[model samples]
Target: MADFTTFLHFPISRCGIHVHESCYGGLPVADPEETRWFCEPCQYGLIEPPHCEFCPSRFGAFKRADISGRWAHAVCSLYTHGVTWSQEHTTTGVSWENLENSVFGRRVCTACSDKIEARFGVASRCESGMCKEYMHVTCAQKLGLLVDETDESDDVIVAVPRYFFCKKHTNQENLKTFQRRFEQWEKAEGRRITVHRRKKALSGAEDALRIQMRETLEETIREEDRGKSNGSVAGGEKIKQARLLNSSTEFFDRFETKAEDSGLSKKEFRDPFYDIKLTNASHVPIGFSKEYIE
Candidate 1:
């Protein structure tokens, strides 16, 4: 079982209760139960002790950049570098230090298999509160797991909550798992709401429950709309307007009469344009010669 308050431990630790049973470990610990003994120095200097920052694997030949000060697997490094972090950073409004301390230190996203960067990426641990599995914002979107955050109010723009549900929760038997996930999501969102309230002083009108209910209602309406006939009441009205505009011969006749009264030919009305001829300046004025004629 995982605690809802404390950050999730790395996923690799979920393999077995006894850490020594982990096959990925380079060396076995004297006391498998204790965290301190999990990463005892290996006999061979070839495999160093520290866990790779990017993946749940032991490092062989790794890369360490000054920005993160941590070693990561070659593939993980490549993947992390490829991610566009700037947009996410701006949206989350999370400081690098808070991200580092609370979210990213030992965590790796199960979706991308890349080391979660505190400064660059936004991620959430599995809401199941069982495994240490995590998902990146982009990966969740790609999977269609993320909720549509757009709404008429600033609530969506200001504080879009990201919730993560583990794969196990897909079945009805895992109702407890689902409940745990929701509880965790609410717990996390509570802190976000506090910050939002302080910054904008949002009233109780848009409570967490209201926002959730509104989203549910909106989703239901969308589904209902989709189920209806393609030619909806609104769609039919639009078609009628288009047909009226197309078939109104009297209106066209009136327009043509106006055009004729304005001295515009049908062809000219369709493609009205002017042709100008360039001429050199004349010394004499128009309708008058250089000297007045007798």
Candidate 2:
């Protein structure tokens, strides 16, 4: 089974992976194994590819303007603000050669491609789904995926949400409220995030054991809290706690595979080879009955 790091060597020798915001940070590689190759960076969803600087995205198409002058992505330049480069000169003008190499063969930027889409609309996509015409990087940014680089090499991109109002449509007053909600998610789900990190760093059955232990610990804590609050303890719970405290190798037959995506074969899910995705937080609905909460 090919892993996330696997790349292809066929009709499409994709040099690098292209990731859009809606599709998470970006696909690590263009392989069929990761059918759902998406990142779940908690706050940020998917990242998108950067547009060619020569495109009409924001500054308007300045094609053939002077491949003479060295160019750089807007985001990269931002970091090197105030640095000056001359035109026609190699190192003198273009401080960022990596970006210059991107347009070497003269590729069009997302801006011009978008115009073509406008004149003869093309398909564009983001979290909200697909778009009819080609939108500038700015338009895509407005939609959510804020591309920092306007270079060529950068293929994969991350999608950033617009103003935090897309999902909940929160007003200024609600911003802090939403922040608190996310903070709570982080606090309660910190271990989950760690689990995700470990999954990426480690693989195979060892990773599976880590996840199982995390879940088991979380469950134990919840149960302990519940018992303390209710002033009552179940007889079995004592045995469970004792087992948990005994050792970390308490498999207790909690092994075997778990199917992540549907239609995938019955391969045992010993542990995921890639990073774990956290689509939504583990939170109770706002308006649950008191009895339900209890």
Candidate 3:
């Protein structure tokens, strides 16, 4: 008989695949056939005949599809889910929580329909007030176009904004000037307060982002440096490591000392009381030699 296991942990499976007694406050696992589920989405029954929106696959009980009613390939769905796969490369992991609010309508590249939601390549956007097109960062640079720069100093490759443009829509000359000035401003403001880094030469509406970037860069650099220092070898870390090693050595030495003082070889060190007979309180030993007691 088909069981609830048919849906567990499968993509598009609405139910948890593997469960534990600790999952629900130490609740016991109920029989899958006997347990009654009330949630409309939880019941492992086909609500409607399945038709994949992305491909010509026919859906069944075992085949998982998204619960959102859109059954595209996992790759296609990832693009609509927003936050590019490239982000997982620069950052730690990928999450689908932001998919519902994704600005990208689909996972296909805005320039080319190739899948951009996978971890295989990089992607970017235009930061102009308008235009939400997607393109590869290298693609932008290859055409001598400017991509967004970060206020983040430690972010090896600065990430482009979510809403970026391609070279076709942006002016190269203006963008080049902006990039040059941005670099200059960053070097001058290396690790100082934003107010102290403010440049009179950049006092204009267009340069407003430059001022804001200074503040953001300052904060980001400060935070990263603070975190690094806290986790680095300079912050008493070596002392702590030495202390831990010393403590472990002391512990092992004490164990060895106890073993040596016990006066029993490894083969002779069996539990002596494991099979002893005990009839009453009087059966217990009342006295022992001082050497044996010690």
Candidate 4:
């Protein structure tokens, strides 16, 4: 099923485009006449992408809801603490309501070693629950932080980090934890593949078995007919019943044999990640935290 909550489609003049809720929130509210609503790209006849007001980037830019002719990246606005949308659905207003300058002023980008300037650069915080580190969007990308970019639409590319651990947190222990998780995933994948192959083979075997059973039944009926012609109908009926019962037993036995051969009767496959308990209220995954499940 399509997740309607994640995205919304808006008709911009003649062109229609699907945008994320966060991105849509940053856009200016549509005029009374919906037909007059046009995106920045269509509104301004610009060949090049518009620069973001918050960051020095052209990608994933959305018009600031309050400020006319000003734009900011959805990722930039989201990670920037105190920034919020006015509406419940986030379809209209975007503003930095009750923004604490102390937090913004104090945050020094770990990647670039620069202070996060006011109303210009947004700081993306470290993924570690206890860490108080932050980094700029471009700086994070340049420093090889796990930046995940998703193509939201043909024109919009939403880029954000999957996880951004500070230099202090990025250690051998975390690497080992990641490796362990990956190994578990590989094992799960292997089990799935084996199960699929076994099912396919079992299906083929059942088909063949059905054909054989049909042939046996046809032969038995022919033999019964011959016996009837020779005046031995009662004997033929007993033989036919015995053969039918045997065939039924053999069919069930094949299923048990297949199950044993596939090793499905042993231990069932289960995802290892689900067993892990959250270490803190932040709900950071096992590999990303210091106190992860072994």
Candidate 5:
């Protein structure tokens, strides 16, 4: 469902790997060759993997545009405060604008119990809204924090992991909250199903009644017509037929009037569960293997 038309990509001519727009923006600019765009690993001609300046891990790393020969993870750059990218679409710049006063250097990581020094990755706060806990991105990942990959806009190409929450909030608290919501949803769904069944039963009864009324009216007409064809219908018989026909008409009219007065056709029942979203149930806690959880 993502619109990929607006997502810009830079293809490495040498390796044929296409980099995301945000990743390419932080990478060093290529040489002035018409068909020569190379990624950091290909350009630098390194056999070993490049280390991320922000984290100890070498995975998901890109060369920093501001600092020559320095690398950082795209997720780290996004979550870290004071980190900024170039405004122009074609420019390459990811700078630590004012990192001295940033929380990365000030706050101690809760997971590793160490201050996140400069060039050793940035600190990311717990996303529980009120928790003052901070952790390095790698530490957060190792400690079962929820890092949700989200695409907020089509204008930006890179899908960043925006949502972060500690294990307590993600596993325990959110599980309890979701269980409560699910119970409520089940009750509401039961009520809606009951209402639907009752409505269907009522409609079936109405149809049955209408069919009976129509059959009765048709029988009356047939009997009257047979009497007329036989020429044996008396005045009394004629009067009885007329009364039966009038009664049937009045009954149908009364049924229609009652249905209109009940406003059954004017309103509809709306389910409260239609708009209820259970977002907490969808997110899986990080740092845990699926096999282990199972």
Candidate 6:
């Protein structure tokens, strides 16, 4: 007699697997000892419409496969049942939430895939089950995920079901907030006045985003410049550099203009003018050249 662990989360307990079924919502049948389960008593079983892998709660129940060595959950297997190995990559450490929708074909992250769809109003998916990413057809192009690839169909990568999400997507309350917001948005979009207001808001947001990007770039450039100068002298050096550049530009502008107007470029003015005497004959007049020539 094997002891059944009752410490199972929702639908997966040892009682659900081996021992008494009815304990923790497990309907494991003791009749044939084959562990047969009907829908009426399943702990996490869905009803009617098929339970989508992307949805938190699906409509219909999924039949657990006895894949022998496959110990992954029914939800995990339903989407990514075939993937065997995983490769590592440098990523932003964001989690993916499965989005439950008809257009996205039942298996895409809720936050990334659904938000993009809702915002962009487009629908598309990757080539196959192993591709593991979704986007609006245009966004996929914008984000550089998919671009003219006839050979893309041949490349096979393992698609693991990702349940992870960024901070925004992780909070159920926050998601509800967003849902409410979008609902309001949909209602508001119906009106011309609201549309105008939304356009203004979006414009302001774009402007803010541009400003933020500029600030970030400027800060990064400043940090790089400071890094190149060793901390001790960098600040002083930067000030001196600014002053030097200011003075040089002011002084050279007159010379540059004269040189250009004289039908000569700066490069042309260099070596020839180096040999030609540039004198400030403040006291000496141009007529003094007559004495020398005569």
Best-fitting candidate, measured by lDDT? 5
Q: Model 2 compared with the native: what TM-score?
A: 0.19
Per-candidate TM-scores read 0.23, 0.19, 0.21, 0.36, 0.40, 0.17
Position 133, candidate 4: lDDT: 73
Model 5 worst lDDT window (10 residues): 240-249
Candidate 5 error regions (>4 Å): 1-37, 87-91, 101-105, 112-119, 141-163, 171-294
Tell me the spans in candidate 6 whose CA falls farther than 4 Å from its real position. Answer: 1-28, 33-36, 39-41, 44-53, 62-76, 81-294
Candidate 6 TM-score over all chains jointly: 0.17
lDDT of 5 at 135: 68
CA error at residue 144 for candidate 6, angstroms: 26
- Candidate no. 1 TM-score: 0.23
Instruction: Flag regions of model 2 displaced more than 4 Å.
Output: 1-24, 36-171, 196-294
Q: For model 4, how does the per-residue alpha-carbon lDDT over 31-141 read when each residue is reduced to its tens digit?
A: 334333334333342333444534434433354433333345555555555665434243233444345322322344555531212112445677778787777554443
Clashing pairs in 1: none
Better of 1 and 4 by lDDT: 4
Give the deviation of candidate 2 from the true structure as CA RMSD: 24.6
C-alpha lDDT of all candidate models, in order: 0.32, 0.26, 0.30, 0.40, 0.42, 0.28
lDDT (tens digit, per residue) of candidate 2 on 170-283: 123444444554455435344443444444334454344434433443344344445444745443132111111001111211121123344344333422311222112123
Question: What would the per-residue lDDT of candidate 1 be over residues 1-294, giving only the tens digit for each residue?
Answer: 112233323222211112211111122233345343111111111123233433333322232222222333322332332321112322111012212222332233456632212212224555565766665533432333443232324433332343545554432344455456645655644554344334432246323333443344334334333344364645322111111110122233345578889998976643321121111213224333311111
Better of 1 and 3 by TM-score: 1
Q: State, as a TM-score between 0 and 1, how close model 4 is to the true structure.
A: 0.36
Pairs of colliding residues, candidate 3 = 12-65, 79-107, 125-164, 126-163, 126-164, 126-165
User: What TM-score does structure 5 among the candidates reach?
Assistant: 0.40
Task: Check candidate 6 and list the clashing pairs.
Answer: 21-26, 49-60, 95-164, 95-165, 96-164, 97-109, 97-110
Single out the weakest 10-residue window by summed lDDT for candidate 6. Answer: 85-94
Where's the lowest-lDDT run of ten residues in candidate 3? 20-29
Ranking by TM-score: 5, 4, 1, 3, 2, 6
In candidate 3, position 285 carries an lDDT of 42
